[model samples]
Target: MNRTPEDRIVELGLVLPDVVSPAGSFQPSVKSGPYVYTSGQLPIVNGKLVMTGKLGQTVTTQQAAELAAICALNALAAVRAEVRELSRVRRIVKVVGFVTSVPDYSDQPAVVNGAGDLLTEIFGRAGTHARSAIGVVALPRNAPVELELIAEIAD
Candidate 1:
């Protein structure tokens, strides 16, 4: 708990990539009062999706999970851009993950754990939050996974 979330990210050797530009009219993140909400983030690096295709089709659960982690990092980047620092986050309030999957793929929660686990590692107890994992047939840019986060800012 002594280590800050930013410090934990560096200790974990994970770099938050640059925030990707929103593909549409919406902002990447919006801060209102004590909370910051990030738009859906894809598993993109340097402006390109890491992988495409549905789970149980061309992507495996593990791969999707990794991609979901990348989405989490991207979400953090968006949050940082809005709030100016991860240290300002008091806790992660909510997370919603979407996975493009084959009809029979019923392990959406497992994939979303990729994001949740990383957040837990970086923020410790504060990372725990209410979450929803959804399965869909498609996503923007054909990303295998996408996630959004709601973070409460410290006063």
Candidate 2:
């Protein structure tokens, strides 16, 4: 039998990686009213940061896009943990994604679509949300992608 979303998460081997550790001493996530907001999550595996540098430079756009998706997945893990269950996720709300890009790169938004696309695939309609794709010089830990999430949960 196929795994449900929760089981698929486990099958995909996601372990949440200890909530990314509050790089500048801010909480990884905060609950305000019925929403849980997550800080940026980098593509990390086995407690070590993976995929670094500017897109279209040290990293290809395709690679950066994939990293961006993983970052969103991690963010989802954080949100699900906070809301206590995936079932509480009423809507994705918004996703703010940041990409490390070279000065001339104008495909930042396309790269971030990797995250948005995955969210839709996983959560179906609930994953559709307001979004922002930001381009920056660098991200924490020099990661190629960093993503933040805002999710509305059940009462």
Candidate 3:
């Protein structure tokens, strides 16, 4: 029996959170042709941020990494909202992560691995994708991390 992405998520002991409503004029995700582009997703749970602070200041690398994973969950929620099913995703094409941190910090990749690792666990090889981890001055809601995902979908 073939397992679907939703099944894989359950097997990995995770659940997709409710999609965060767009706070701006943009849609949470837009599907064009065979791809879905998502807006940046924050580490929110139950309609609130999990934490707020700069990564190298009040937040530790580990904490930021965990938050990155949460952002991935929110990203998945956005994809589901667009495609109507997790299994519709053929593969994750790319992930762009932004971390709010003090100027001197330079461990962005380690923080982003949290999301990549979880994605792999949930989607297997399909989760693997190109990624960029960027350090920024700040993000919306003062979130420690934010992530945007691009996925190729099936018809």
Candidate 4:
């Protein structure tokens, strides 16, 4: 039997967390046609932000990268909440990551790679997608990293 995406996630020693409630009026994810778009997800676990601070300052690059992975995981949870099954995903279309950084920090790509690598590990080739990593002065709830995803789903 083929290993499902959830199984791959489990094999990697990660459990997808429950879909987080929207902080504001916006929905966590929306499905349109064959696509599902997730709102930007913070590095929150168990209803709390896991880490906060500006990268290259209180938060190191490595730490921010790990937080980015958590944000990706949350984004996946949002996707699953909408589609009701990970196996329904046809492919990850795109990823947009935001990193809060101190002045002069320029390693945003490496930080967001934490998410990209995890997606590839779980979904194999389908996980590969176009991506944008942006650096900002701050983010909602003071999260160091946030991630959003666009995925294509099967009919």
Candidate 5:
């Protein structure tokens, strides 16, 4: 909570993208009290999906990891839009990452780490938080990963 999140973003060379409108009825994020909850974010870079396939089948773990990072970035973008100030974040509360994978694949944690690690690099310890890396039967648009986040904001 020492170094500001804006400074952290700069340290990590990350700039939040504009929060894209939800493809459906849901909002990108909702703020309650000092916390912001972001909707699940798909890995869309430059407004295009990088790849699409179930992990351990047509997709490699490395690619899935990268996709997860993009999801995290998207989640942050939503947070910025919802709260109007990334620097107001005191710390990341938690992350829920979902992966589309083959039945035999059990590397969901590593894939989600792509997002978790980026948070650490960007916010240092303030980014550290509880998390769940889940493997699901499938994801929307067959994305390799989807990420959602909860963050605590400063008054």
Candidate 6:
């Protein structure tokens, strides 16, 4: 039997949270033609940020990585809200992650792997995509990590 992406997420002991409401003036996700683009997602759970602080200072790398995963899950939620089904996703085209870190921190790639790895685990080969992990001085809400995704969907 074949499993859907949502099933795979459940198998991994992960549940997609409700889509985080936009903090400013943008939609959480927008579908254009055959693609869906998600706004940057933070690790907010139940209306509160899971963690806040710089990656190399008040937050540990491991914690930041987990937060990155949470951000990815939130991104997925936004996609689902727009597309209405995970099965519509044909390919995860791209991922961009941002990590708020102290000046000495340079392990942004490793931190973002948490999101990349989870997407691959859920969607298998379709999850493979180009990605960028960037470290910055700060992020909105002082979040440790943020993530956004672009996915190709079937009409």
Q: RMSD to the native, candidate 5?
A: 1.8
TM-score per candidate: 0.97, 0.89, 0.97, 0.98, 0.93, 0.97
Per residue, candidate 6 scores C-alpha lDDT tens digits across 21-60 of 8989999999999999999999999999998899888998
Cα lDDT of model 2 by residue, 53-139, tens digit: 898788888888888888887887788768776767788899888988888888988888988887776677888999999889988
Residue 120, model 5, lDDT: 84
Per-residue lDDT of candidate 3, residues 1-155 (tens digit): 98988888888888888899889899989999999999999999999999999978999999999999999999999999999999999999999999999999999999999999999888889999999999999999899999999999999
lDDT of each: 0.94, 0.80, 0.94, 0.93, 0.88, 0.93
**Compared with the true structure, what per-residue lDDT tens digits does model 1 show for residues 17-46?**
889999999999999999999999999989
Output the lDDT of residue 144, model 1.
Answer: 90
Model 4: which residue pairs collide? Answer: none
Worst 10 residues of 2 by lDDT: 14-23
Q: Give residue 118's error in model 6 in angstroms.
A: 0.3
Candidate 6 TM-score versus the reference: 0.97
Model 5 segments beyond 4 Å from truth? 1-3
Which residue pairs collide, candidate 3?
A: none
Question: Which of the numbered candidates is closest to the native, going by highest TM-score?
Answer: 4
Q: Give the local distance difference test score of model 5.
A: 0.88
